[model samples]
Target chain A: MKHTLSVLVENKPGVLTRVASLFARRGFNIDSLAVGTTEDPTISRMTIVVSADETALEQITKQLYKLINVLKVQDLDPEEMIDRELVLYKVSAAPERRHEIIEIANVFRAKIVDVGRASLTIEATGTGDKLAAMEDLLRAYGIKELARTGKIALARGSRDA
Target chain B: MKMTGAQAMVRLLQKEGVEVVFGYPGGVVLPLFDALYEAEGIRVILTRHEQGATHAADAYARVTGKPGVVIVTSGPGAANTVTGIANAYMDSVPIVVITGQVATHVLGTDAFQETDITGITIPITKHNYLVDDPADIPSIMAEAFHIASTGRPGPVLIDLPVDVSRGEIDFTYPERVNLPGYKPTVKGHAKQVHQAAALIAKARKPLLYVGGGVLSSNGAKELKELAELMQLPVVTTLMGKGAFPEDHHLFVGMPGMHGGKFTNYAITETDLLLGVGVRFDDRVTGKLATFASKAKVVHVDVDPAEIGKNRPVDVPIVGDARAVISAITAELRKMNAEPRTDAWMHVIDDWRARYPFHYHTSETAIMPQYVVERVRELTKGRPTVFTTEVGQNQMWACQYLRITEPRTWVSSGGLGTMGFGLPAAIGAQLGRPDHLVIDIAGDGSIQMNSQELATAAINKLPVKVVILNNGYLGMVRQWQELFYEHRYSSSTLPQDCPDFVKLAEAYGCFGIRATTPAELDDALVAAFAYDGPAIVDVRVEREENVFPMVAPGGSIDEMLGGIPGGPVSEMLDEELFEEVWE
Candidate 1:
């Protein structure tokens, strides 16, 4: 199962190393991870999504908790999480179907980030399924460019993963 | 607090415990090499070729179990390292390859010596980065090391532009690497462990198939315990040769092509195949459809992509091999025993009797098998590491050589990479200086990176190199003779050797030549007795071919045997071998 672990760490020297070394020493499969600062300047948030067994999850969480700089870690379980994915898709919007493409974007609540005479950039934020559906619908219109932030998530309610 | 971009890069590498780098200087990489020169802690060893640099780094990693570091220039230099990167990827060696890319401004402009190296290496590397900002250097380097050394370890590239390496920055190495989608699991699931145990307990003819992942995860002890508890006969892949003690009764030796015939029969007839850390490669499994057809295969791997990539698994456990093996061993403590003593052992013994690792003793010339067996005898299975280059030499080493412990045999299994031995031996020697490390090289393969003798001499690494001089690409020549109607093209080159003894002397190493068995034995003894690197060129017949080989695109059971000039046919049956044995 793919797990998204959010770790809030001190933005300082060798912090990335402390976390990465822990994973390497333990032997875990880290699929795709993104680390950057949140709204706070001093604190850095890392979202690590890797697939492993339940025991591995426990071990990873336990290891993360032991780190001196890591403030928090959450295993964003799929059912209890609201996973949002952002995609910026550039499509070939011929003059005739430009309006039609805009209508499709509106239906998905996606906004047109850029407009060109023969191309359109659609910025969409939703579940992965939603973005995948949007991409499929827009495939007939011809896709020129595609960029996606491979799924990030947060817990649905008072529960934090 | 402010430092030059080059200094920052050096500082970053230093913090990551990078002691040495293998690379060559070029226009694009000059600034980086200059910075390395100025740096105190990091030492750079200049290689004759960029590919050699990468392979040396890879060999270092394979031996040390740490990420090997390689630095090179862009364009041709970067492209040259691609083969090494692919070799690492296929064999899952962790290497940090830092290349000097064209400056950011000149990128995409196709400037002189500029190539889209990052783009070219996308599929080959675990992760790659093009540092646009000097500040990102530390973070990127840290992340690259992390990614390279972490689960399913492979090559990671950092394409640092010349300008980026020269630009000024206030250096503060990253303390944290935050990748959202990249968290690996270090622990095995309790429930899955129990499930695995239950499967093993119930299995009648269970076979344990170990792979390189076991060595990578440091799970040999756990694997041994698990094997002991279950009493399962173990068969390893080419890369998995050293995972278990080959001298043990339960150790059935390697499986698939060139593997022990008993191992092949066990896999073919087994009721359950507990495949741990192996990626069902074509060499291991001749025809996927017929492989382990009678057995229920339970695959355990850290990488999820590999689980269903080859043969579909009856039970797929995605976790670290060591952790999973420990967990399974722990779970097995609760299960009742059905020791496979009488029936299973009898069958395996029968198979062993039927098809033994044999050769017709001849006094015509020195045989490659005799050399390998002699090496094995000299080592006494005390965890002597053997690294082999591709072709007949590699096959001979795998077939005749014996390893008694985990992580003792390193080779380019999946890639079948030639010219892999010398550098790999150097890496293995550096990894464990106390252990005996040997590079079994073919004449054709040795020339690929013969310059690494300098690297060994400079480092004073005692890597023993044994070159099987056949004067031809023996494996390919055999293929041409068999399937291609004897149309030998570019396979045989009669007069291209550069007096290897002189070459070794020039590189500040000892060298010897052996034509007779006693000469070969003396050479080996001398090579092992040396305090530093030594090379032994064993001159074998030019037309020699590796036998008991499964013809290309054929089943493992369909083996070809007999001498190169002799009438070849299917090997004799089990009864004939038993009668001879008796």
Candidate 2:
């Protein structure tokens, strides 16, 4: 199972290296991670996803907590949280297919961020599964390139996690 | 009001209650060493090698329950300390290692003597720091000590670049560390304590599985109280040997591989296992699936990660061993819980009498067990600290030497480093100068850091090294003998291996040799009476094997080469015992 942990850490130098190196040392790598400042300027929140068994993840989380700069570790359930990933896909398109791609993008409430002679870049933000479905549907049009800002999530409530 | 980073670090260390520093000087750390020359408070011991300094510091921490420190330069100097760092990390010893780095500008350009030490040590250390500025020194130092000594104690490294050392700052030692992520739980939850007590109260054959954590937390008093209160049998892991008094009625010998037969049997039959400050190490829990198969385990450790690491627990409590065990004791007392233990006690007593640690005497060669037995006999009842190098000698020391005090028996428990004993003995002596300090070493492991004998001589430590000379890597040889048909490849050492007495003389310490049991006793008496460091080498039987052995992957009960009735192959229990008894 992949566990999504929202880790809040002090905004100190080398803390990211410290956190990343911990997972690396344990021979486990994060699946998807996104780091940004939280409401407090001095604290940074990292949303990290790692696929591991309960034992390995618990051990890794314990290791992460050993870091001097790390503040709190809250494991979030995907079903209870509102998760989103912003992805930009460059799709190869002919003049006729370009309009079709734009029509599909409109249905998904996405935007054609860039249009080139042979390709159109579409940007969309949605849940991880939704983005995967969008990528699958657009694959028939010959996707040229893709980039994802991993995943960022917040609880489905005003309560602090 | 103003000082360089090096001076600031020295002052900060003093402020943190650090009294001694261990290091070997090199080119990069000259500035730090120079700063130490000006600082009047701290005492530094210059070891022959960086690794020895680390081990000495580790042993210092092990005995004092304070973080030991090491100062070594960059590159190979830092590399040499890796084994020691890993040893400390594995055993959960608190140590802070300071290494000098190349100038910041020259860090990645393959500068002279520059190594990515922090990168190399990432996996081995609990946490590490790369100092960026002079001002960060106070906070970094504070955090390093805090993180090292707190929670489950582990080694922390600090890499100081040359430029950072020379950088100036106004020294203000941080009053308190600001580490939010590292708050270790010191008190067990109230409900959990009650649940554990209820389980203890109901258990008919409950056992207290103690480990080094009890000793580290100074929980021996509470542990003794709990065992007596509940009338539970106790078996300590190798690291936990001194954590419980071996002389107590409830005390069974060490459990698992190379442990006494009765201890393993007792563990095999327990209904409820109360583990305190212990990880179920393979050596202590032969085959995990079969280990305490019938028991409901209640594990309490200061480190949350260690709670269910090896074996899952029925009740996992994360808190200091001293605090948690004390709390549990308090709960049991409040409830006035009494566990029925007559049947369990009878079985344990029967097994102890049937299979005590045994070896037949020839009067021709000194048995290793006898060497340890004599040490115990001679040093009996006095405040003695026994340290050892790993391998067969370590197991013999563990089996034969009886301990009543925590922090009295220190060894390379996890890493099993060969050279640990000598330097650690020095550190133990340094830590507890008024007590008698002895290192029971093997002929092979002693040579690994025989250089540390110089450290003892120079400091007038008056430590004793009792080398149980079997002329082979006895443990490996024993395995080869039983498992690999005795094809001793690189296991045997030439009998002429640097005559220990001459080597000790070379290092300016008194050296003695014994070939028989009587001679061994005489030599021990002389060594103890000597005013300075001494090494007593005893030529023990060459082919002796540690018995009550659990072949790899075998359950603890499937032991070999000990007193009969075990469900395994036997070599010499009946014959050897008859040979001596007749």
Candidate 3:
């Protein structure tokens, strides 16, 4: 099972290395990680996605807490959290199929961020499943290049993570 | 007052109440050494190698219940301390290591004697720092010591760049550290303690599975009180050897691999296992699924991460060992809990009597177990600290040496580092000058750090080193004999291994060799009376294996090679016993 963990840590040099090294040492592979400063400039929030069972997840959470720079850890529930990932797709488009790709992009509320003579770059931000679905539809147009921002998450409503 | 970072570090050490430091000086650390020279109230013992210094510092911490301090130069000096730092990390010994580094400008350029020590020690340290500014020295030093000595108590390192150490700053040591993420839980949750107490009161066969945390937290008194109040049988891990009185009636011997058959059986059959300050390590819980399967576990540890880590728990309390045990005792008393393990004790006593730790006594050859037994007999009722190098010598010491008090049994329990004993003995002796300190070492292990004899001899530490010379890495050889068709391979040492007696004499230390059982007693007595560092090389049976063995990954109940003519012999399949015996 994949768990999206929201970890708050001190904004100090080598803090990211410490957190990453811990996950590596414990043999837990991070599926995706996005780090940025929080509202408090002195602290940073890291959204980490990892696949682990209940026992292993508990162990990972507890071990993360042991790091001296880590302040908080929360396993954000999929049902109670909002998750988003931004993806860009550079699709091969012929003169006849360029309109088809644009129409498909419009249906998913994606934007044609860049257009070259032979390709159309579509930018889309949504839940992982939604983005995957949109990418499947765009595959027929021939995806020349694709890049994903990975998943970043926040708890729903007024709750803090 | 404004001072150089090197001087500020010495001031911080004084503020931390540190009196002694073990270190090896080099070019990068010359500035720090100069500051140490002028520093009052702190004495620095220059060790031969950085590794030995780290080990000595580790042992000093274990003996004195204070965080040991170490300072050394960069690069090779810093790299040399990795093994000792890792050993301390595994065993949770508190120590602060300071390494001199190249100037900040040349840190990543691979300047002479430059190394990223802070980067190297990340996983092995509880916390570490690379000081880029001298102004951060006071807070970083305070945090380093605080983190190293509190909670689980592990090693911490601080890499000081040459320029940073030379930089001037006004040094005012912080009175208290303000680490938001490092607040260790010291008191157990009331409800969890109540739940644990309820389970304890209801348990018919409760067992106290103690570990090193008991000693680290100074909870031996509370542990004793809890056991006596509930009449619980206490079985300690190897690291927990001295945490409970070995002579106490309720004290079962060390459990798990090489533990007494009765003790393992008690662990196997117990209804409730109150794991106090113990992480259910793999060595202790052979085949985790079958380990204490019948028991409801109530694990109390200072580190919350340890609870339900290797084993599921019915109740988990996160708190300091001493505080939690005391709380549990008080809660049990309030509930009027009484002794209910009479039948369990009867069964345990029967097994203990039937399957006592045994080895064949010989007339000509000196049995290694016999040597350890004699050491125990001679040191009985005396304040003695016993340290052991890894391999068979360590297991023998664990089996035979009876430690009646905390801080007396110092060995590398977690890491099982080979060359820990001799240096550790030096530190132990230095920490507790009134006690008789001895290192029970193996021929192979002693040779790894034999150079430490120079440090011991020069310091006149009077640490006795007893080499159980079997001409092989005995533990690995035992595995080969049991499971690897006796191929022996590279395990055996050459017939002409360095003469340990002569080696000791070369270091200006007293040396004695006891070849037979008759000469063992005199050799030990003479070595103990030598007044300075001494080494006794005792040649023992080459093939003797530490028995009552649970084959790796096998359930602890399925033991092999217990006492001859004992119940285990009959309990085990005839063919398997014959195979082991043969």
Candidate 4:
């Protein structure tokens, strides 16, 4: 099962490597990892999407806690948390296909970030499923290139993640 | 006071209550060494190699329950200590390693003697630091010691650039470290403690499975109290040796691949396994599904990850071993729990007598077991510390050498590194100057770190090296014999193996060689009597194998050898024998 973990760590040198290396060494694959400074400048929050079972997830959390810079780890529940991923797609849109690509982008609430003679770059932010659906439709217009910012999540309501 | 980083490091060591440091000097460490030379109340023992220094520091930590300190130059010097660092990492020994790197300006340029030591040691160390400034020295040093010696104690490394070491800074050592992520749980959960106590009080066939954590927490006294209060049978893992007195009535023996047959059988039959400070390692748990299959496991460990790691734990108590064991004892006392394991003890005693550790006697060649037994006899009732090199010699010592107190038995238990014994004994002797330190070594393993004999001799440590000269890597040879159609391969030593006696003499130490049983006692006595380091090489049977063996992946109850009357396969009925092979 895929688990999105919110890990808070000391904003210090090599903290990222300490965490990434731990996951690598323990054979836990990180599906997606996004790091950013939290409200507190001295602490950073990392939203890590990893695929592991209950036992392995427990192990991952425990191992993460063992790192000196790691402050907290929370296995976010899929139902009780909100997740978003940003993706930009540069599609090979000729003059004739530009209208169709723009129409599809409108339904997904995606923005046309860049336009060139032969391409239209569309940017979208949503849950993983929503982005995948938008990407699927854009592929019909022949995607020239694509970039994705891995998923970031926060707990529902006022509870801290 | 303002001082150079190297001088501040020396002051930090002194402030940390470090009396001795095991290290090897190299190009980049010159500044640090110079500062150390002038440091008062701290003695630096230079080792022949960085690896030897690390192992010696590791053993010193094991014996003294204090973090061992090591300093070495970068690149090759740091690389050489990898094995020793990994060994300590595996066994959870506390040691702080300092590696001198190139100047900060040339750190990543591959300058002379530069290495990414912190990167290399990340997975092996509990934590590591690569200092960017000299001002961080005091706090980093304090944190390094704190992290190394706390919780699940393990090795920590600090990669210090020479320029940083030479940089001047104000030294104000912190009285306490502020590591929010590293606060180890010291007390077990109240509900979990109650649950564990209830289970223990009701268990009819309870067994206490102890490991290195007990000794690491200084919980041997607490462990003994729990076992005696509950009248539980005790089985110590290789790393847990001396956590409970081997002479105690409740003591079964060491349990694992090379452990006693009865201890393994008891593990198989127990109803409740209250594992204290032990991770159910693969060596201890053969075929995880069947290991302690009949038992309800209650595991207590300082590291929460260890609980239910290898096996499913019934009641997990995450706390220090000393705290948890005492809590369980206290809880049991509150309930007026009575000893319910009399029947269990009877069965254990029966199996112990029926399947004793045995070897065939030969007048022509002395048995390795006999040598260990003699050493044990000679060192009886004395403050003795026994360290062993890896392979057959280690297994033999584990089987025969009875350790009555904690910290007396030190070996490379987890990594099973060869060449650990000699330097470890040297470190052990220095740590406990009044104790008799002995290294039970193999011919193959002794030569790996034999250069350390010079260090031992120079220090005049009364350490003894008892080499079981079998002329082969006996463990591998035994494996090839049993599992690979008797092809010797490359396991045998060269025909012109070094004369260990002559090597000892050249190192300015006493040397003795004994080829027969009659000569074993005399050699051991003389080596023990020597005021300086001594090596006693005893030629043992070349083809001998350590028995009571659990074939890799085999169930613990079904052993290959060590049956009292005869081989277990032949003795059992045809149907049962088929199961044994299976």
Best by lDDT: 3
Question: Candidate 4 residues B1-582, lDDT tens each?
Answer: 999999999999999999899898888888899999878998899999999999999999999999999999999999999999999999999999999998888878988877788989999999999988999999999999999999999999999999899999987878788898889999999999999999999886788999999999999999998889888999999999999999999999988898988888788878899898899999998889889888999999999999988988999999999999999899999999988777678767867787889998878789999999999999988889999999999999999999999999999988989999998998898899999999999999998999999999998888999999999998999999999999989999952379888899999999999999989999999999999999998998888899979899988777787874332223334343234324
Model 4 stretches astray by more than 4 angstroms: A158-161, B564-582
Q: Which pairs of residues collide in model 2?
A: none
Please give, for residues B1-582, the per-residue lDDT of candidate 2 as tens digits. Answer: 798999988887888778788998788888899988867768898889888999999998988887898999998899999999999988989999999999988888988888988888877888899998889999999999988987888999999998999999988768888776678899998899999999998886789999988888888898898888888899999899888888999999898789988888778878899999888998888889999998999999998878888898999998999999889989988998875787668767877898888888777788888888889999987899989999999999989999888888889988989999999998888888999999999989988998998899999999999998989998999989999998998999965588999999999999999987768778999999999999998889999989878989899988887787563223124343334433
True contacts kept of 2: 0.83
All candidates: interface RMSD: 12.8, 1.7, 0.6, 0.6
Across residues A120-142, which tens digit of lDDT does each residue of candidate 4 receive?
Answer: 99999999999888888888879
Clashing residue pairs for model 4: none
Regions of candidate 1 where Cα sits further than 4 Å from its true position: A1-161, B38-41, B336-338, B381-383, B562-582
Chain B TM-score against the true chain B, each candidate: 0.93, 0.96, 0.97, 0.97
Please give the distance, in angstroms, between residue A64's alpha carbon in candidate 4 and its true position after superposition.
0.8
Q: Candidate 3 clashing pairs?
A: none
DockQ, every prediction: 0.05, 0.64, 0.92, 0.90
Q: Model-by-model lDDT, in order? A: 0.80, 0.88, 0.92, 0.91
Over A37-128, each residue of candidate 1 has an lDDT whose tens digit, in order, gives 77888788878888887767876886575453577888876788877778999999988999999999999999999999999999999986
Q: What is the DockQ of candidate 1?
A: 0.05
How does model 2 score by TM-score?
Answer: 0.94
In model 4 chain B, which range of ten residues has the least summed lDDT?
A: B565-574
User: Candidate 2 at residue B256, lDDT?
Assistant: 77
Model 2 C-alpha lDDT per residue in residues A127-149, reported as the tens digit of each score? 88788888988999999999999
